[model samples]
Target chain A: MVTFALHGVGVSGGIAIGRAQLVSHATLEVAHYVVPASRVDHEIARLELAIDEVQKELTELHGTMTRSGDLPGEFGAFLDVHWMILNDPTLSEAPKRIITEQRCNAEWALTQQMNVLIDQFEQIEDSYLRERKADVVQVVERVLKRLMGKPGSLPTSVAEERTILVAHDLSPADVIQFKQHHFAAFLTDVGGVTSHTAIVARSLAVPAVVATHNARQMIHDGEMLIVDGTNHVVIVNPDRSVLSEYRLKQSELDLERQKLKRLRGKPAETIDGHRVELHANIELPGDLAQVLESGANGVGLFRSEFLFLNRAGLPTEDEQFEAYRAVAAGLAGKPVTIRTFDLGADKQKAELDGLARVAPNPALGLRAVRFCLAEPKLFLTQLRAILRASHYGKVRLLIPMLASVAEIDATLAMIDQAKESLRERGEPFDEGIEVGGMIEVPAAVLAIGGFLAKLDFLSIGTNDLIQYTLAVDRSDEAVSHLYDPLHPAIIKLIALAIAGANRAKVPIAVCGEMAGEMTLTRVLLGLGLRNFSMHPAQVPTVKQRVLTSDVSAIRPVVERMKRTDSPAKLAALLDKLNA
Target chain B: MQIREIRLRNAKGLHARVAARVVKVAGRFRSRVVITVGERRANARSIMAVLMLAAAMGATVRLETEGPDEQAAIEAMVAVLAAAGDRA
Candidate 1:
């Protein structure tokens, strides 16, 4: 068979070889629009019934998704949003008018109304508000088919063994159903670069290739293929040589990944016994599985914002406590630092009502402590959660975006309130939960003395510090050249944060993309920042870097960078340090 | 009910890296999807389809999908096509 190899976007990691079936995604087969113009009321009633059926499915899916003690606070919140949309008097009432006035099919009517809503969402300046359009559209798509009695036709139930299904995009519903069968791999055409589908695929370790153009049209049924998740390579039919070569490489990668697994329970130390803390930056408690797989010392940064962003509304104290408790319990004896939500103005996900605030630059806007101060109730619930979770494990509460002594005082005051309430309710907690602030803003770096004096510990968020100090958006291609973490200013500020924290006899660490980079690993080690939190994949490489260097030997270069002005000189210094 | 034939203009064709990129991008739409490259065609919605296309570094293929999202379907396909080529 003539084999074809394809290079596409790799959203998830893994490898799979399977036969091809150029099966496009199975879509709902639209039956002919049979509704008479005269029998609009009767047709409308039928549409309502169909919509009701989909609503029932949506609700049912929500209930089935929870672990006995573990509530899906985020997804449950999404369902709440869906529930509201389902019963929204305006949306419900408008469709009827469309049916009467347009005399159109209910599906068409619903789609049009959704378009108007999506348009209004798009008009809002906030990207998060606009992204909500996706959720709204998803709910409508579910309801429309039910209303028309042509509820979307799900894919022909197939035993997914050795079969890789490709699609443009998948709804949360399809993902749940697809997981039931043992799929060889998955591919999609459209998902936000860092979308939920990508998150799910990665979580499942599915060899997923996304963003393949016309994937639905390009694949036929039961054709042999290979999906290389490492480089996101996919091979359809392979000649003998390529096939044999890939089989070898696949085995090698498996063995290599397996070898890394053995590194678990081993200390991340240099050949000469220079121990370094290698903790993982876990966004969710579920991420603990991979963190342990990588043999992380602990979670250096638990992004608690996920609890807020993942859910639809504010999570209750009990709900937040349960989620945090799971993470804390999973860590067992290891330390897990929980960082509170750092809501900023630019992020539409905040959903703070009636604050017409647009900052000239969100990086410098009312974010983190500033935003938390603005919404005390939101901050208090999270504080209560972290404090409650502290009893379960070696948990420490870390706050982000701290700029002043006042922000620190105000934050602790709320914590005090939470403690008082818990005491009143007679709920026990770790009263001695160590509280700390992340040193990210330039102001925080300058005011480090006051923070270190009051705070229990510190973790430096290098991404923001670099962005704020150097003024660059690392993601924007236009200023990609400006995204230099090794800039003398950034290097100096980090050194200052580390030095200041150490002087106060407080432990400090760096947890950002910069800490994960191979080049900067040694520089940070010499700067007195011994703790590192990074992506799980980056842990091994960073550990490798740590093992190669003596921190004492690496200090001179860090010192040299502080005295330099030229980028060329800095590059030369880095090459020397790496050498 | 429609089919559009297009050439993969990017010099790299549908290489492994490009195919993964294409699959990642194509997964964003919601329509019945498929593609054909020569006598072999796979579900464009399947990683196997684009991988099967193996249209070399620069090749041509046809795309088809049927649904209310067909327009977005075509545009997103072409967008990934151009992006995959560029990335490749």
Candidate 2:
């Protein structure tokens, strides 16, 4: 057996040894023949019919996705992207040109058109576009399958056994279809780190190495392969010693995973008796199960945006009430910190329609509470729903993107209006719900004293705080490399926010991407952050770190880190502390 | 022809989603629109062509529109590119 290795950018971290499952339909075999002059119109019509079917299929799939319950906002966005690709004149009109001018069969003509489109995508300097070449290929393949009279069913899911999926590229739809099967790892010839497939792989906790260029061509079906996603290496047909070494590594990882799972029941406290609250940031009502399973103390950030997304028109108060009630009831009296409608910015604008403007930079535009405040009718509807549900369980109101005390005062005033209106209607609701604000903006972080005076609690939204402070958009690959969480400025900001909250005796929490990261848990704890709100899947791992860490040991180190001038030194200091 | 120069203020620059938005708005006008970033020129109404320009967050691109709705088209395209306070 020929043994070899391939290197790729590791998008997710883990080690897996699985049988390679080649999912190659890479180049569809299409016959090129001159269409009869009279039948040119007929061929064009045939292609149009196939396009209609594909669109119909996509519409149905989008419907299914809206109902899927576990997916993130990106899934819907990618679906829309694919829909746009299908409808683009490049796809529809260009192929017809080949069919009419060259008198070629629809299938061959479509392939030629797709090649031109791919070439255009390939020429785009943005690597994001280069990665999107897979998306173009996926769309073409779907159409080609239809033109060829073949059922375009995605390879029947990843098999039950530990299977390393070797594919030219797996679309988000294909990944969703393979939902039931267990995947040890995924290696694709095409896919960027930001692609939906890569995002799903990370969320699923499966090891994945993408943009490998030719993993599908080199790896044979049913062959034993070792995927080390952490190292960005895939071992094909490893000899006896190598295979055993990987087997040992895999078992160790399995044991570590089990150990983390066991930490679910343990309290998240540092070794020196500093107790910290660990909560989950939930995206949907369905996530409550995972939250409870992970033993999170409460729901820290219940992103209410999900109800507003993928639906036509605004969600009625009753619909919002029902969703909030389910989560409140699900938690069984555990405090649910509901952040009101952090919509806009990366959210689909289809539902918003004319209500929202197309934000050029949504990250800084009318989003979160700003959108809520501007659209008071919409804001009041959500506030009324949240207030209505507060009576059922322990519900805390959290406002996102609070930059000034004036905004807070206005929000509080609105809350009073909602309550008075509720009182007049004789609606039963909780009158003393705890109010909080997300310190996402750098202004908010610095103005924590103002918030602490008016708010019951505070949560740092480091995701945006880092982005705004660093002037780096994490989603923008062009500047994504500069998006650093451990930068001295960020650490200093977090420390200052926490210190301010601590001095004022206001409870504080971190509910951002940084909270979910295991390595940063210790650093955050060191910075005097006593509460962490992250995804449920992250709770156990973070709790494990919390269990082992000594706050006193890290406090001094972090104090020095905050004073460190260089960004490199700041990172080194954090690494040293973690070590 | 009406020509207007604007900077990409969106954090992610004129990426796919931004380009899609640009194409959608540009397509609404009868005007033939062209966007020029640095040395590269792209058709404002075509998503692929607009994306090829690869305008980063701070890059300035000139929008040129020629038709009956030239003024309106340039204004709309500028609003999208300048994504001003209503960030992406």
Q: Judged by lDDT, which candidate is best?
A: 2
The TM-score values for the models, in the order shown, are 0.68, 0.63
Task: Write one digit per residue (lDDT tens) for candidate 2, span A231-283.
Answer: 99999999999999989999998898788887877888889999999999976
Candidate 1, after superposition: displacement of residue A485 in Å? 1.9
Q: A-chain TM-score per prediction? A: 0.76, 0.70
Please state the error at residue B79 of candidate 2 in Å: 36
Highest TM-score against the true fold, candidate: 1
Off by over 4 Å in 2: A1-13, A20-159, A166-176, A186-203, A208-248, A304-324, A343-352, A355-363, A388-392, A416-429, A475-481, A562-576, B1-88
Grade the docking of candidate 2.
Answer: incorrect
For every prediction, compared with the true complex, DockQ reads 0.01, 0.09
Least accurate 10 contiguous residues by lDDT in model 2 chain A: A151-160
Per model, how much of the real contact set is kept? 0.00, 0.16
Poorly placed runs, candidate 1 (over 4 Å): A1-64, A68-71, A74-165, A178-187, A206-252, A345-350, A353-357, B1-88
> Which residue pairs come into collision in candidate 2?
A360-B88, A361-B87, A361-B88, A362-B87, A362-B88, A365-B87
